[model samples]
Target: MSREPYRARWAGTDYEASADLVDGRLHLRLYGSAPADGFEKVAPGRFVRAVPAADCSAVWHVTTVCEWHGAPFLVHTAREAELLIEYTGGDALHAAGLGLERIERGVYRIWVKREEVSALSEKLVKIVSR
Candidate 1:
């Protein structure tokens, strides 16, 4: 599925990053210098940069399951995805609690509408300014 990239500004640094979810993978890239400052999909919320900048050594994994209400919840395991409540039961009642979208049979990805990143940026600005 095609999707617009999610852009985010670093909380206290002059750096920015963008994430893209494509073909069941999340790709992230930093616009500034950092350990892992390349365009690649590593882990859900982790990045690693090689010391030589060409070591090409890294590993990443996404969580396929999460805990909610003491129960195992199947999730698509992506930085952009939320809790997939379909496993419990694709019933309307469950769907209402947490928006659920089936990515495939027996697998689902949580639905989190595009958030207003600007609002979060503003909040970060306040915290940093203090």
Candidate 2:
């Protein structure tokens, strides 16, 4: 069956957007306007939220993923990885070069150098998660 396309405009020209109902997600390409900070310009990911339109249609925003910016390194062992998973730091910690990708749990991986790698990861997680 045919579905109604969502309409939007970008760069001054008019455009259209469409979606497909897949196993567990909706996928689409879109051009549109949003609040100044409505979106981030990074690469896309799976998560999203729907905003209700006046007429009850939905607007989709690609959600951000959890990622710690491990400056200048990579996790080299299971013990280090385990340390990262168990760490969570807070405000006082942020100033110490630590943080977490709190939007969601980023079990992805970690990067680090010698000294305080786990401390850094824990501190960051607390700041963002809190």
Query: Residues 1-130, candidate 1, lDDT per residue (tens digit)?
Result: 1111222334333333344455555444444333443434455654532122112122122223344433335443234533223244545445445544656665544543333111111112211111
- Clash count, one per candidate: 3, 6
The model with the greatest lDDT is 1
> Which pairs clash (backbone N, Cα, C closer than 3 Å) in model 1?
35-49, 36-48, 36-49
Compared with the true structure, model 1 gives a TM-score of: 0.26
lDDT of each: 0.35, 0.32
Model 2 C-alpha lDDT per residue in residues 1-106, reported as the tens digit of each score: 0012344233333223445555555544443344222333323432222322222233322211222443322232434324232223333344244443333352
Q: Candidate 2: give the clashing pairs.
A: 89-122, 98-124, 99-124, 99-125, 100-124, 100-125
Q: After superposition, how far is residue 39 of candidate 1 from its true place, in Å?
A: 10
Over the full model, what C-alpha lDDT does candidate 2 score relative to the true structure? Answer: 0.32
